[model samples]
Target chain A: MTKTKKDVKLQQPKNQKYAGKAMTKGRYIRSQMKRNWVGYVMVAPFLIMFIAFTVVPVVLSILLSFTSFNMLQVPEWKGLDNYVQLFLADDLFITAFSNTMLFAITTGPASFILAFIVAWFINELSPRLRAFVTLIFYAPSISGTAYLVWGIFFKGDIYGYVNGWLLKMGMISEPIVFFKDVNYIVPLCIVVAIWTSLGTTFLSNIAGLQGVDRSLYEAGAIDGVKNRWQEAWYITLPSMRSILLFGAVLAITGAFGFGAIVDNLCGNPSTDYVAWTLQHHLVEYMGTRFEYGYASAIAVVLFAIMMGANALVQKFLSKVGE
Target chain B: MAVKKLRVRGHRVVLNRSKGGDVGITVMLILLGALMFLPMWYLLIESVKPLGERNITPPLLYVMKPTAQNFIDLFSNINSTWVPISRYFFNTIIISVAATFGCLVFGSLTAYALSKIKFPGRVAMFKMIQWSLMISSTITGITNFFIFIWLDWLNTYWISIIPVWASTLGLYLMKQFIDANISDEMIEAARIDGAGELRIYWQIVMPLVKPAWLTLLVTTFQQVWNAGASGYVWSEQLKTFNSAIATISGVSAGAASAGSVVMMSVPIIIFIINQSKIVETMASSGMKD
Candidate 1:
């Protein structure tokens, strides 16, 4: 009777272990699904919207480049014709390409440098003053009102504030024809670009500067670094390298992707130089001429240029980060 | 010992003295600030001037005779538009408010979840948000437009509010703030106390993330309020201040001048009122890694 009882107890223990394992596994799966289900649901709206708006459009744009579709007609497969026309025959494409490069090269670096200087100053100030100064500089970028204000300032005639101020200061004998003259247009736009570029990047730069370890500065000082310039070069610059790189990328992309300001200010029939760039061509063809295929081709080239620029910047940033 | 002490004290005094470089920095900053503010100042002065007074050579710094005629003209002209200016204002208010609120609510929620909830694909989601930040809206503009048309959502507030609601930058900002500030233990404790995810988010996370939420709200408001493309696309009937100015001015150079002046000033006025907030938010965001 004792032996029989022992065998039964041993069998009962084995059976209970298997059942316990199965139950825990089932519970684990259930709880995980329950916990994560809401998260999935929460992110679903954004994911759906992104796929619908961004992902689908990008894919369609690539496909659309191969077809000759004006808004009025069905998109017909044109193979390489749209691409050929943009590269081979389009003078405006070339002009826009050069103009965009010019804008990007001149404005990108200049804005970054200016912003860095401003950021450095703001960061060095007392907390109260820093806040106040930052607000003054950043206000224009957020507020669309700066453009309106700048419009009056850049008026071509003597009545224009800038021209008037220049004349009063004896800087020029006559009102400078700023907008009408092609030579002046790009430069004028660059000025405005820099003015507005003091947006979030400037703040970021300041933040970046602030995040630099104080120990590095103290170490440099102990090592006989005599001046702010030396301190900045040896410590500040290296520490804030990532932020600087990020700011530079933002500047470059912004300068290249610029459209609205130039479109609004310069108008179409790009006055002189290479002001008629890819963005203008694309907008003109798509919006006015309704030529979707041609526009897509232009966009493709623009996208390539932007991607190349971004790649170069990323490489530079990685180098700096190291 | 006395001689060594005197030498050390002298060295400290020399270090405390303001350097020439510091003076140079102060001057440069002041000049830059002035340059930055000049255009807006010029615009404010011009806006209050009589139309005839507007053409003065070397535009007046201070209007000798201030007039409300420009504002009056703007209001009356807006009233005359087929879709009354009031509707445009109402539309702008609704769209900007909705978009701002949406970003705040959705951005904070997603940010909180990403920061607190340990789930698969969270890192992937964060990375995707960063990638989106790098790509300019221009690339997505046409795609967004077509999508809206397909949904038969063209000319509706949804077209404007929906796209902007999922602001990558806002989400990133919120995530950064939560990561830096919020403690996981606090959230877990709340969960243990039988608090639902939404309840904890509202009661705990939301309060903690107020600063980030406000920053996103202000930034999103500015972007949406000045939104140009969607406004032009969806509702031709509800023209924004920008489009209205563009239409009137694009017809002729003379009209363009007057239209530009009026159109530009409205934004400038808003900037003046919110200048301090704008700066603080921008500075805070920019400072972030």
Candidate 2:
């Protein structure tokens, strides 16, 4: 029995070593596979969605732009005709381009300046008061309810709230046709845009301003920076540069995406000063005429424009950082 | 001693003079706030006014005699045979809630993986998410619309809810919170106890990311609520509350205007009640980053 037990013990170590080496190799392969498998599993939904919804659609739209396809019939190949027509023939396209430029120029800087000033003011307030006032300013932007009420306030008729008030105050003898008039369309929209835009950037800027180190302000004060304005210039503005740039990008993107307000306020595209905006044309083609090919061309142009704008902004921002 | 006392008094006067400057600042801010609130307030007050009384000169700042008729009219008009107002509300509620919930869940999960897991190409994935922000959903809307057409999803709920599920903003924000608040030790401990990564995320990490989850919830809710385009395309059975109001009010000349007023004001009224909380949360969280 002793001899047999010794033999068993000696064989056991050799067998154990063999098993251990094999198991280690298996475990390594399994873990490596598991790691990649899990990673891919976690990201699968996003990839599927991004491809099906985003990447696929973008490619299809580009293809559709080259074809003359209405919803009723299959798409037929049409070379650069749509593009040529848009550039040379479409009167409304030029109007839209100019109008979009005007919108970008005006609303971009205007909203930024307003949000900055508001943020600066809120920064000076006590914490609780600052929170309260910030909420009040942001309320307009987030609430769909605000837009509902705005629609009523700017109603074009004499009985419309603004017209009635103006007439009653003897500011104007007759009710101003704010919505119908071509002259007032862009300006009125800009004002409305500014009102809605106050919340997002205001909150962001205020948050950015708070990140400015307190010691910087103390140092400036020691150097005879007698007031908040001087402290803001020397300390707050420099510290909040990134936030400012982020806000500007957001503003630019928002200006380009100005469709809902314009559609709601102005009943038809023809009456709109900026009727040639990609959104307007695409909606018109889709809804009324069903000119899918032409609409796709318009969309492609707009997409290119948006991408170009984004690149330019990115370049400008990077330059600012440098 | 007398000369020193006079100089001290003069310094006090100079300091006191700036007290007026503070008042000027206060007045200026108050005016700006008023300007911001004016249009919204005007809309609400006018919505409550009787149609005949709407044209009052200098406008009625306060409703002299408020009526429930507008609300009553809106309800009755919606119930009419021409438009399915109740169905539209249901559709909106479903889409918005589903989309918001999906964003929170999916965003949190992806964020957890990005934050906790150390793997190859992780940084590349993070950058991809950031770059996605530059690609506006508006630019993709047309393409998405066509893709849905191919998928036979037109006039379906999936059209609205699916596209919004992969929100890069929500993912970015969630990742930020996880980085700030959550610790790697917690995950290691969970793993040591034989808890799976999914279990760790569900049982431990989720609770810690509540603030970010809530913020994303509110923002997503707001976005979905104001959504006109997606629903306009996807669900033929669906008519948004706003669209219904616009259509009804735009078509009907006289009695329908009051109904339109109610429909329009309902969303705003809901907003005013929750505005304080929403704004405060947004402001605080916004400052944190």
Candidate 3:
């Protein structure tokens, strides 16, 4: 994420060569610092709070993952016992792990591609039409507990919308217990997850579509870009790669951390832990069992998976426009 | 419409042979939109439907008869004698508003310094911020809860509002917007006119980045609002309306829809009103060519 700024830094040496008398790097940095005291002052508020809440907690969580703490007493260092227990002993954690991976694999790319395609299609509309369509796609994400309404739609009994309609059409004599049955649980949760996945990433992609320079299309046309598909591949996709990559990062993180939607749509710890995610596992230990160290270990595992996925995406995205 | 063509650099290429293609795309968009909208639409209708119709065989798409009875029952049916729905509403409103306000102000402040100022360690600080994004909040969830407990703020509203002030995404967006639009020359120009940094930020940068801040406002508001009852608030009266709604929704189908309606109305309304502006601001949110 931070490497995006490297290109700008690369250009500075060209400007530095034009100076008649070049100062030492140390002196130049000191001069820059002297003039930018207000800059530090400006950032202090958020920086202070960020360090306290985010930075400190991350360190503490990593440390806590190595120890056993129940919050009432001092933490006892347990080394790899928490991790061993998480992997080998806890059956629920294994269920949550597989479920989370299943979710991430299925929903992550699905939503990422869906969001981009929808954004691209919406970009082709007239401005007013574009805004309206964007809102329609975005509405699902912002509507809190709206997926719970899907619970009504997929309710296990005849009262459910899907079952009622299917039953009326004579498609099925019995109502499918979508959330309760293990067979339907993952699939149903995936559908609702995709619906709500058009979130911040979708918004950013729309912004990215809008941010594309109009001149690039003109240039592409002159370069023999023969069709819309060609134009998108050669011009639009490359231009918006940063936002595309940003969306991918968020999507990967969101997919791995897919708990809220499942928790809301299906029951928490879903039926027989069919839809339980690593996040649900972490919460089970953190919030319910109060096994802080074990929970931290679960979190650390989740975090490691996310970082790996992020690295993979970064590598893939760096190849964009190549 | 408009010949269904792309006019690129005076090279007008008709992308579609017939008007049917446009209609087909439009129809597809509408279908997808309806799919996206079905749950919310159902929520609105179901919330008002009579309780009998809610669980009836072959559920009605459009309510034959609508009543506010469910909404009435939602508030009236709470078993708890002490905590009213209104108190949950109050707690969420105060927490979300305060937290949103703080996040915007502090986030933008940090972003301004990082984006516009050539301060030492600015890059390092931003890199740190970016690194934080890789770690999910769940990793820190226990630690935060423990911190709140140690501070003796477990049940207090401050636990909900305070720790959330440092918004990484907000800072990123603001920095991107400020870098693209708010130039150092503008700040220097203001400084030459005897304007202080604080005055310059308030007077100059604030107006320029109103669109970006508004975008941040919607996102941060939605996050905080959805975070109701899920966070550190344990007290009955201190619980957020969303958490309350979560429990209430489990009561019955009608009550669940009502809870959905109640939980969603504010953010949805806010999004509707600010939708266009948010879209416009997004054009400035990322790096410029």
Kindly report the interface RMSD of candidate 3, rounded to 1 decimal: 5.9
lDDT of 3 by residue, A15-127 (tens): 57536667889977876787788898888888888877888888899899999999889999999999998889989888888989999999999999989988887877766
List the DockQ of the predictions in order.
Answer: 0.30, 0.27, 0.42
The lDDT, on a scale of 0 to 1, for candidate 2 is 0.66
Q: Is the docking of candidate 3 incorrect, acceptable, medium or high quality?
A: acceptable
The regions of model 2 sitting more than 4 angstroms off are A1-37, A71-74, A116-120, A123-131, A143-145, A148-155, A165-173, A199-246, A270-276, A316-322, B1-25, B78-89, B176-211, B228-289
Per-prediction TM-score to the true structure, in the order listed: 0.79, 0.76, 0.87
Please identify model 3 stretches exceeding 4 Å from their true place.
A1-23, B1-24, B75-87, B180-209, B243-251, B279-289
Candidate maximizing lDDT: 3
> What's the true lDDT of residue A274 in model 1?
37
Of candidate 2 chain B, the 10-residue stretch with the lowest lDDT total is B1-10
Weakest 10 consecutive residues, lDDT, candidate 3 chain B?
Answer: B8-17
**How many residue pairs clash in each candidate at the backbone level?**
10, 2, 0
- Tens digit of per-residue lDDT, candidate 2, span B1-289: 2221111243232211256667887888899999887765665555466666654665667788876555555556666736467777777778877998888888888888888876556678887665555556666666676677788887777777887887776676677567655668667656655678788888877765554565566567767766644544634476455556555554333334454445434444544444445445444543222
Per residue, candidate 1 scores C-alpha lDDT tens digits across B123-149 of 887776655555566666555566777
| Top candidate by DockQ | 3
lDDT of 2 by residue, A1-322 (tens): 1234554565455345346465676665555455546656676787677667666766788888898887778899989999999999998777777777777778777887888988787776776687668666766777543564555566777766778778877898887777677777788888888888875456557645654555566555545556666666666776766566556656776777676677767666636454345566667776678777788787777767766776676666555412
TM-score of 3: 0.87
Model 1 agreement with the true structure over A88-175: per-residue lDDT tens digits: 8988788888888988888887888888888887767876687678767876686554565566677778888789989999999988
